[model samples]
Every structure is written in C-alpha cells, then in structure tokens.
Target: MEYFVHFLLAILLTALSYFVGSRIISDGVAIWQALIIGLSVVSLGALTEALGAPIWFIVLVPFPVGMLLLFLFLHEPLYTWFFTYLITLALYSVFHVIMSYFFSFHSLIPAWRLS
Candidate 1:
C-alpha cells in the first residue's frame, strides 16, 4: 500500500515537473509524454528497490534512464531535454524532502526498504 501511494505520487510529481521544466526551457511536453516519463522513473525505481539495491544505487540509477526517456519520448533538442531533466530532478528532490520529513514516509525515489 505504501509503495502504491509512492508510485502514484511519483507519477504526479514527474508530470508536474515535466510541465514546469518544459516552461523553463521554452519547450513543450505533451500530457502523455509526461505520464510516460513518470511511469518509466517509478517502474525503474521500484525494480531497483526490489532487487535489494543499495540506497545510493537506487537513487542514482534512475537518472540516466529518465533522461533517455525524455529524449526518446519528446525528441527535443539537447539543451531543452537536458535542462528539463535537470529541473525535473531538482523538483523531485524538493518533493522528496517534503514527503520524507513532513509526511514521515520512505524516500520517494525508492531507496532502502523496510524490513
């Protein structure tokens, strides 16, 4: 159940971040594109967690996958896609902090698991 909530939140966050990032880069991301990126991120994160990956690994592994997804899905130029990826990550970190501290939840990006 917790993982389910986290997955849902991650999808929404990713979509919102895509919107904001697109605006920042003066590029555009379709709604479906944003959702696809979000799904890719969360799915990869969940897979890493299930594999007993270390916290650092879990957090770091998803970055490239997401960036690639952005390029593949949006077909944006380097500057636009790269910056959008960076901005999305930045916002994800902020939301992760909020969710972790305020909500007392596990990390949003899928790190260590509870026993």
Candidate 2:
C-alpha cells in the first residue's frame, strides 16, 4: 500500500513537473508530449532501479534519457532543451521537498529519504 502511494506520487510529480516546466519555458512542447517525456523518464528510472542498479546510477539515469526524449520528440533547440531540463529538475526537486516535508511522501528517487 505504501509502495502504491509512493508510485502514484512519483507519477503525479513527474507529470506535473514537465507540465509546469514546459509552460514556464514556453518551449512549445505540447502538454501531451511533455507528459510522454515525463512518464518516460519515470519509467526509465524505475527500470534501472528494478534492475538492481546502484543508488547513484539509478538517480543519474533519468537525466540523459529525459533530454534525449525531449529533443527527439519536441525538437527543441539546445538552449531550450537545457533550460527545459533544468526547469524540470528544479520543479521536481521543489515538489519533492514539499511533499516530503509537508505531506510525508517518500523519495522520488531510490535510496533517498527526506524525512
């Protein structure tokens, strides 16, 4: 049950980050495309985690995949891609902190505990 809750929270945060990031960046990446990129990042992260990767590796895995997916799907230019990725990361971190501190949510990344 706790796992399910964390899973749902992770999904929600991932999607929300991309949605908000795209809107903030105004990179013209559609909402649906943003959603796909977000979900893909989460899915890839989860897969690496499930494969028994190290904590650091699991944490690091999603970034490149996300940037690649962003470029491949949205064709965003270099600066936009970097800025969008930065925004996504920043938003996710902020949301994660809020959820963890205020709502007692689990870490979005494995082997991490904010509580």
Candidate 3:
C-alpha cells in the first residue's frame, strides 16, 4: 500500500545518501557498496518498526548501527561517520520536499510522536 511505497522511497533515498556521502567525503566508499549498505540499514529499520517501536526509535536507533556498518563495510574512518549521517539527513529531506509537492502524504513531517 502507501506505506510500502514510502518504504521503498526511503530505501532509495538511503542509497542516494550513501552515494552522495561517499563521493563528497569518504572517497573510498563505492557506489555499489553504498547501495548494499543503505538497503541493509533501511531493512533493519523496517524490522524494528514492525516490532511496535516508537518513531524516535525508528529514526534514531539505526544510526549507530549504520555508523558501525560503514566502518566495517567501507573501512571508513570514524570522522566520515558524521558526513554519512549528515548526507543521509540532507538527502532524505530533499526527497521529502520533492515528494511533498506531488503527494499529500508527507512522510518526513513527524507524525504520531511518543510525546
């Protein structure tokens, strides 16, 4: 359904983030590898979401795991973790802005918070 569409879009954007981050900062992280890592992280997020986790948990928890994954997978330095996360957020926001123009469904606009 709609959620599935959003999920796929999110994974795609995640891949885009990895591509951007690798190119701009971590020169060693390949596009192919980025696609794999991005897909894996988003998949983990989706799994956690299905377990009744909160929005913050869904948005935030996978970050450290992602950082670890980058280190392990790309042999990237700890410093590049910042750029990786930063690029993900930036690119995700860009994706949201564009999608918002076409669809009323605003996934990036925080909904149903714990508080």
TM-scores across all candidates?
A: 0.81, 0.83, 0.71
lDDT of 2 at 36: 81
The C-alpha RMSD in Å for every predicted model, in order, reads 3.1, 1.9, 3.8
lDDT by residue (tens digit), candidate 1, 52-104: 98879888877787788777766778977778778877887777777777776
The TM-score that candidate 3 achieves is 0.71
- The candidate maximizing lDDT is 2
TM-score of 1: 0.81
**By how many angstroms RMSD does model 1 differ from the true structure?**
3.1
lDDT of 3 by residue, 7-60 (tens): 777677777766776677656577677777777777778877788798788777
Residue-level lDDT of model 2, residues 14-106, one tens digit each, is 877877876787655677777787778878888888899998998898888777876676566788877877888899888878887777775
Candidate with top TM-score is 2
Report every candidate's CA lDDT: 0.74, 0.76, 0.67
Q: Rank the candidates by TM-score, best first.
A: 2, 1, 3
The local lDDT score (0 to 100) that residue 97 gets in candidate 2 is 81
- Cα lDDT for residue 67, candidate 1: 82
Cα deviation at 94, candidate 3, in Å, is 2.4
